[model samples]
Target: MNLFARCYCRTYQKVFLLARRFLDFSEPDLLEREGALKEDLPATLKMTGLDHFFLVISKFLFDKGVHLEMEKALKERGIVLTIYSDVDAEPTFDLIEKGVSLYKESGSQGLIAIGGGSAMDTMKAIGARIANPKKSLPKLGGVLKVTHMPPLMVAIPTTAGTGSEVTVAAVVVDKANHDKFSINDPKLIPDIAVLDGSLLASLPKSLIAQTGMDALTHAIESYIGHSGTKKTKKDALTAMKLIHEHLPSFYKDAKNVEARDAMLKASYLAGLSFTKAYVGYVHALAHAMGGFYGTSHGWTNAVLLPYVLKAFGKSAYKKLAEISDHLALTGKEANPQTKAAAVIAWIEELNETFGIEKNFAGILKKEDIPALAKHAEKEGNPLYPVPKEMNAKELEKILEETMG
Candidate 1:
């Protein structure tokens, strides 16, 4: 088979897996098992009392008949369905503006977001602006900046990465500023989410590995981040175990529906964990790298994971020990302070196994360090708890080490 044929065949496999997952969607009596699904889908979602939902998803994730099934499902509930199928990476302001305008024109009362982070962010932004037309997109940031949002928002992540489906924060790149600003409003949280592992079986192998790493980082960083609470810790520990057991296989055999299913489930759990606990400096650094160079979010995260952990590994040893044990990288006599070295080594090994070049200078320039460091600190400093307390010079050292 030609390259295109090989790719198409894999996509076909992914679709078949998705169809099977649909069959398993929920024997959950929505009433009796609401708590169980809440782990997969949150219960904190506030319904805005909207009549219909507009789906915002990437073109790639739109299948031949998925929309028809969704529409049929909504219609049974008296909800109309409209779709805006153009969400892309690093969502620009124009995209959000366009989606919001379309939602208003279609009179869409709520949003259903599918695909990855970009689509979810766009849908959340549209829902926010649709309910409050007066505020400019740039005007809303920080806590509770937007008070009102559309009645219902459902986020279903096709990729097992990004955790954008459940998180209260929405990120968009301000191209002018060359930075990503997050809108951290409780109202931005989606009311419903569907994590179907079948949706992930067709993802490109490179993406499968990269996004899987992103989910792993979410689980780890949340466990050690500033906002981590008892609840977030519990969720994150479980998320870590799930990923540790499944991510390797998912990467090795992308066609393994069982591995794909576990990955999707792990991603959902990680998303929920991070949504409450928030992320730490690894994400802080990755976000800055993405804004400055337009680097791929997951690939960038994969590259930075070890170095960022190394930077703060001393202070974070206690948490790292737990992860190391979960990953089975430990010696009897090794203290967590020391055993964490094994953890870092294993992460580097995984990155190498996944074909992510951790040593290369990824979309970064030495000259850009001062600006990037400042922006990273500005953007992520608020939420990261286990800070290594880095300055521009220190950040330059980190970039220098990572580049090597």
Candidate 2:
């Protein structure tokens, strides 16, 4: 990185960190239990005085009828519910616009998103559009662009990843331009977050592995980043510890209620950490790849995380060593470099166990490396507060290694 750009990025991050002290970064009201969705969600909605609301879900979950009990409960309470399940794995601007139209036409006063990150993100983006009718979605991109609070949004995450329930970010794809970006603001945080472990019992093992790794990535990145507060660091460490102990057990047996609950708590803690401290190069690169190839965000993060950390090298060694100690991955006598290597090796081992490929290889086109690097650099610099500053050329070198 150039001297001028490095200085500017550091200054920008410092200013934001100082300003954050006065901001209200509140957590959502939690409804955590095995049957919260069916037993508690409806009554919670009634308490909010929401006579009508949109139930946002993915098509897969909708087809499975996973939310039937919740729907029945809402109907019994005389609360009008409009189901919108057209959300895709990677939500686009066009998709959000359609959801916004439906929301306005249905006279819905609130939103309840049930599914993975995509559904929650779609609902958040839709709420943003409805709140700020005059601003285009693209204009709402970057930090603090949302001037108005979204609707009374409730996020029920079926998968333990993305942490969209508590985070201040909604990632949206611009398919026409082949770009992906986040709409970030405190107002985008959901009013309530429901952690129902029963909803995750039917998830595929592959999905559990990917999303669990995604949560781990959030924890690691936030803990290692330059912008983390003491609270964020502690939250990240707790999340990492929970995931270390529970993710593998949950992956082996999806019906393990205790493990499932632990993973959910880990994911939420990771969200709370990253929403304040923010993520780094892995997320930036993952977003670029997802935009161009429509890759799964969690899987992409899983693949890119080790590579990014390795690239961070000595800059990340101390923090990574601390993480290794926190997770008890290495003995107390291990050197910082050795402990850092242990952390990376542990991630690689988990990926291998989950049947995740070590490299993009055949999936990533060599010709697109330049553009991908540019996109990552644009998204990361002066905003992410990464452990080590990297320019586009350096980022391109890292991308080349991922091709294997």
Candidate 3:
């Protein structure tokens, strides 16, 4: 057998082995709040973020049943809760400052972050700022800059994407500079991650689609990135399989609790994968594009995923082939390249089914292409072990291709 054939055989065996182990394996200390919002809100709230916590949330969640239930429960427990629901998608530094001010003013002893990546990220930023009051936000960029850990920070993901609940990094936009930055530190990771399906039950289908795709991007990019380890790859593979099988169902029926639960689990697994393995061009560019255009972060990620995978090509063939196999996108007889291409085609088809746009024409500016490309490059280098290192010219072409 040739190199391709050997990889095929190995992947085939590994798939079965992983399937058995993946189902049996347990994650470290997760708070599964399936009916916690309805049945045990006070206990759940206290268990996760502790009493007197600040809830950094989105307007959607704030208006929804989850926050209401939480408020009622916490109030019953004599737990004074402070809510800051002014969080915007792809949150800016100004937003972070606003949250910080609220957190301090509220005199909350703990933190509870609800909603998607933006909410969680904003909460994380607030926690970081409180812990490192002397350091500016910009000074906290890059890896492990957090000297103080936030008090009892808990993350409850309303959307099954971004995996911000488990990740050690938070992406905060500098809207003034028309760019984005990250706060990377192990301390930034939430003390607890509460996966509550009730929180996601009323999520809009568009949000479900966007956030699901973001989780998919996280799993795919982590699996294919050069930094992937044996453990991370296993998590990524399990996450991809779960996401591929369940995201569509969850998207179609927002009330499908089973599907929502699975997707949320997948999101958590993907978060674990990417936090350790790291993401690639998809995230790098999505961050820049989102910052510059104020586009939806997950939508940009959904649009750019296939293009970035295509760029990875042979460099990520083995991993892509494995993903294709897990998703049943290709036959065992297929070569690695063929399997990889099939995965890409499947992704494109998936996007089409969900009505995601392939082009970024409305979102991209031709003149901003250079800046976006350079920004992506700055983010991709050193931090992310992308399969391919994209230079400015190459990235510009990508931006141009994405342009309408």
Most accurate candidate by TM-score: 2
Q: What are the clashing pairs of model 3?
A: 361-404
Rate residue 396 of model 1 by lDDT. Answer: 61
Q: Write the residue-wise lDDT of candidate 2 on 1-404 in tens digits.
A: 98999999999999999978877788999999988999888889888877999989999999999989998899898898899999867678878998999999999999989999999999999999999999999999999999888899999999998899999999988989998999999989999999999999988999999999999999999999999989999999999999989998999999999999999999999999999999999999999999999889999999999999999999999999999999999999999999999999999999998999999999999899999999999999989899899999999999999998
lDDT of 1 by residue, 1-404 (tens): 24564355445434533443333121111211212222332222223445666888787666444455556555655667688887667678888998887888887766787788888888888877887888888888654678675557777776787877777778888898887878876677776777666566567888888888899899888887645667778778777777777788888887787787777767777877776666766787788888888888889888988988888857778778877776677865678887778878877887988899976464577778778777766655434444345545556667778766
lDDT string, candidate 3, 245-357, tens digits: 89889988999988999999999999998887778889889988888888888889999988888876688898888888888897898999999999989888879988999
Model 1's TM-score against the true structure: 0.84
Worst 10 residues of 2 by lDDT: 87-96
RMSD over all Cα atoms, model 1: 12.2
What TM-score do all the candidates reach, one by one? 0.84, 0.98, 0.89
Q: Which TM-score value belongs to model 2?
A: 0.98
The C-alpha stretches of model 2 lying farther than 4 A from their native spots are none
Task: Give the range where candidate 1 is weakest over 10 consecutive residues by summed lDDT.
Answer: 25-34
Candidate 3 runs further than 4 Å off: 1-28, 38-41, 44-50
What is the alpha-carbon RMSD of candidate 3 to the true structure?
A: 6.7
Which candidate's lDDT is highest?
2
Whole-model Cα lDDT per candidate? Answer: 0.72, 0.93, 0.81
lDDT of 2: 0.93
Model 2 has how many clashing residue pairs? Answer: 0
The list of candidate 1 runs beyond 4 A from truth reads 1-51, 63-65, 75-78
